[model samples]
Target chain A: MKAKHQRLVLALFALAGVAGAGVLAASALRDEAAYFRTPVEIRDGKASVGEPMRLGGMVAANSIRRQSDGLTINFVATDGKASVPVEFKGIVPDLFAEESGMVADGRLRGDGTFVADRILAKHDERYMPPQMGEMPKNMKAPATT
Target chain B: MHAYANPTRFLAIAKPLTPWLLGVGLLLLLVGGWAGLTQVPGDYKQGETARILYVHVPAAWLGMGGWTALAVAGLVQLVWRHPLSGIAARAIAVPGMLFTALCLATGSIWGRPTWGTWWEWDGRMTSMLVLLFLYAGFIALTNGDEGQRQGGALSRGAAIYAIVGAINIPIINRSVVWWNSLHQGPSITLRGSSIDGALLWPLGLTLLGFSLLFGAMVLMRMRRIIADNRVAARLRRLADDEGI
Candidate 1:
């Protein structure tokens, strides 16, 4: 091979090596890599009781209920396949509402309820102007705080 | 490629090209900024907060794009021993770091209203932060190598680091998909964009404007590096004549 071709081969080999390493490393760290587990994962025994972990999924419609103290709230997080009941105490972030994605960080109780220390709202990938009046049908219904 | 390796020829092309790039780039940015900030309507869900996408998305693109440039230059430097490649890589580092930092800052600001947190250790966010640190490290390595009489070793080391660092780029791109992240998945894909056409056009303008500006800045920085090297070589020659 010419010198140029040799160098090209060498560069290609290096890139392949790096990519292979990345794939292997990613697979090895698969469980740790995910930021959160869905309700289905928890139901399938992916999460352990009293072990801190994040549960991520859409907040079930009409699932939000505020306690008398006004600080604590309860809701069910669902991925359609399964649902996990979640309880949180604090000022929930703006955009936290029904029919939207949410990730709660806390622990699972033995009884299967998730006690959240922090709650973060997850925005979906869609964007449109409010004037369009074509918001997702479910989002049109206001959250019953 | 080799013809441009000659600094004089490179400068001949770069000098006149810089102004045109800057002028056009600035004009596009101004128009795009106006359109994004004032012309476009607020998002149905996010309201005015979504306006930050114009700046944030471009910064994110360049941040990742800059590293890709570094890796390509690094490969050329290693394989062809292209003299200009090192200068090109050095020129890209600072602006790239700045854009990466801008992405992080803007994303954080956007996150506060959207994700309700200033930062998260999720896959996408963490990988981006890692990219910033990589840029910082590359800059420090190349700058430290400057004083050495035999410059090839550290420069080559930096180039190799640049190539290796590129592994993070793909990781960053796929993080949202490969792992669950607080950050949303890709909004614009090869198939189509999820954003409405009304909101997407202004974003396209800003992306183009920011990209043009990044190219111009890199060219200007390369010219500056070349001029500084010329001055340094001249001073060295003068000192030699004086037997200092």
Candidate 2:
């Protein structure tokens, strides 16, 4: 083959390699990419139950309840507008605390609850989450007191 | 392409532009850093740590962009046989690798305070690390180990490696969306930026500054490569003439 033809053939192989990797990656991403939602989204019926997803919000004050198993903890995640009760089975992260922003990954139970397999603490760059001085006017719970 | 195909013409254009790019880039970076640090409000969510975005985002962008430029040059060299594209590809690798490393370091530092971990095998972070390795590999293949004589095969192999390694760039970009990782989703994108205008403007300035600096470095390195090639050609001719 001429030098040009040889170069062309090599280039074709490189392009094929890239295309193959992209297709495989796309397939993997479809299965792996989990979408994030909020309590408001769950309340609005936007979050799909039974599908694994990520929920991020502040852990409601005085909402944490540890089960007898000692490994499971229950809490309500609130975002000033809505709240979702979350049941997570595992040791919560060190930063996990009431009034601190947190994210949980798990499926939504049929009974309007989040069954989290993993819990991650979420905080802003400031070493603190937004202080809950007063509950929003829309808050239905008297947990603010 | 014709004008730049010749080293003399390429230098003629690059010589004047390098200083302008480098000087303005440095100045804008300083201004952008000052503005990001002092002027911008502490983020409601991220607070002062959001300032890291000014440096980290630009470094990530340039790192990704540098690889894209290398791939394009590799294509040019392989397909069109552009005389100078090989030199351009070689010129791009070192600084590109440095930027990739910088992005990872800054990102790791930012992650520690925010994500509560120094590092994770998160999709985004892991892919970025892979990109750094790709850059290192490309540089090694093209430049070869010191003291060993490298042949044309290494250059051809480098060009092919560059084209193939480009597969990782998109992977690095989409990794956050693709995996359940600790990293945040995209903030600035082509569709529309989610950040406030106050934060976005300084970020833009820093991006431009860093991109210009990257361009200046590539141009400067290309000139050196061209000069070195000229000396090598002269030495070869002298040896041939002397029958040595």
Candidate 3:
């Protein structure tokens, strides 16, 4: 009987674990699932609102703007196929983060600015770039923050 | 077959490596965490939230890695009948479930700023969830019976389930690819690497740490299990001899 009870406890724990996993999976999909889409995807009514998501593309070269609050910045992120204007209310990411495979998070407000909460940049494809530039004596990565 | 089943011999070899394994596991995990947390640059986009990747990605990797290891361990136990394999299998489950859960949780956290929803039935997520269920199922099946007859056999079940789950893991991972779906394509290296240096280095370090940690923890737990079994058998024998 005690052993049977032990089995019950293990099963309950397993169930609880599954429940926990399910909860997390659901939430992840809700929050992170957006950035997976293409420009056509968001335009094709595939984007979901009322939850967070990642939006990735090139920041259209000259479309960036800083709002009056000084923290809110707006820009257009595009896949070259289609473009989505993005608005972010935080410190700007690395300068190189733009015009490359830049990622943004937030939402498309009614006014059409994507209110971004986060930004990510992808690495370059060249595995071994020529370390051509002379290094400064105390060089560090340039900061845009 | 019984040659390796001798717990005494197994203990002789295992005891020496225990501390070393623990030490290495600790060292790697600590260093990995620091590298992931401090050295890695913040996401140009996500800000501080991207820090979760150090934990989340490694957890996801380990979750998958644990089950894969279990599947193999299960096979060994079933075929080789290594008395320790069952212990190994059982040991793997706890961390397997833990890492899988971590993966799911971290993925959700990453989603909030990206997906705009807390949850979705994405293919990769669903399959990983299924893996979690499989881990739970394995634990339940093994832990169900008491006497040697009913469900006493776990390695056999575990091996079978692990293989089955192993076969399914890919299916789950690729389900979105085969079919046009809402799920995101692979975010990591599958498509020539998407993660930046700020993220990848930490992820790589943490993954190494977690793998080492899994090795150490599984070994420690398996040794303890084997020792307990000996104690149990001894107690039973004494009870029978004394007619208690």
Candidate 4:
């Protein structure tokens, strides 16, 4: 091969090597790469009890119930097909509400309830101006507290 | 490619083009900023916070786009030994770093009220952070003595690093989809955009403006580098004549 062709081959090989390494590394760290687990993942026994992990899903409709103490609140996180009850003892994020996406950092209890230390609101990609009026039926309006 | 190989020829085109690009880019930016800030209604959910999208989205696009340019330049420098390619790569670094930093800062600010956190180690955020670090490392490597000389060993190493670092771009783009992330998935895709037309138009305008501005800045920096190199070459000849 000409010198130019040789260099091209070398570059291609280097790229392939880097890509292969990336694929291997990503696959190996799959567990760590996932920021949170869905209710379905937990239900499928992907998560172990008492091991600290994050649970992410939508807050089921009417699932939010505040305890008398006011700091502690209970809600069920659902991915439609499966649901996991979650408990948190702090002021929730402003966007956190029934039917909105949330990611809770905590652990699954032996009783199956997830005890959360932190709660983060996860908004979807859609962006519509308020002047447009009512959101599409499939999309839920964020609850105003 | 050969036409641009001559620095004077390249400068002739770049010098005249830079001002036009900058002028049009700034005008578009002003219009986009006005429309995004005052003309459009607040988001149905995020309210006024969504206006940040105009600046943040453009910065994020250019941040990734800049690196893609660097990688392509690096590839040309390595394979073809193009004299101008190395200058182009060096010129891209600072602006690329600035855009990446801008993206991170804006994202963090947006995250505070929206995500209820200032930062997260989620896949999307983490990968973007990695991109920032990669830019930093590339800048440092290229600025060393090797980079000062055209096509030096360290410059080639920098080129290789640029090629390797490109791996992160795709990772950053796909992070929200490939992993669970606090950051949202892509709003605009090959399929279509989820953002409303009212909001999307300003975003489009800003994206184009920022991209043009980025191109102008890169050309200006390349011209500056070329001029500095010429002056340095003249000074070296003068020193040799003086036997110093």
Highest lDDT scorer: 1
Q: What is the docking quality class of candidate 3?
A: incorrect
Candidates' TM-scores?
0.94, 0.75, 0.62, 0.95
User: What lDDT tens digits, residue by residue, belong to model 4 across residues A1-145?
Assistant: 8887787788879988998898888777777889999999999999999999999999999989999998999999999999999999998888898888999999999999999999999999988878553656676533321
- Residue B126 displacement (Å), model 1: 0.3
Extract clashing residue pairs from model 2.
A125-B46
lDDT of each residue in A1-145, candidate 3, tens digit only: 5754664465446545655665566455553443345555677766766456656677777787888999888778887788888877776534334565665657666654567776654433211111311235266433211
Worst lDDT 10-window in candidate 3 chain B? B144-153
Candidate 2, chain B, TM-score (2 decimals): 0.94
- Candidate 1 regions exceeding 4 Å error are A133-145, B146-154
Candidate 3 C-alpha lDDT tens digits along B86-106: 677777888789889988888
Query: Model 2 - which docking category?
Result: incorrect
Most TM-score-accurate candidate:
4
What ranking emerges by TM-score with the best candidate at the front?
4, 1, 2, 3
lDDT score for residue A72 of model 4: 98
Sort by DockQ, best first: what order? 4, 1, 2, 3
Q: What is the lDDT of residue A88 in candidate 3?
A: 76
Cα lDDT of model 2 by residue, A11-130, tens digit: 988698787978687777654443357799789987788997888788999999999999989999998999999999887766678988788879899999999987877653221113
Put down candidate 2 lDDT per residue, B39-153, tens digits, no spaces: 8776655567778989999999989999999998888777777778888888899999999999999988887666666776667788899889999888777774421121112
Q: How displaced is residue A70 in candidate 4, in Å?
A: 2.6
Report how far residue A40 has shifted in candidate 4, in Å: 1.1
In lDDT terms, how accurate is model 2?
0.78
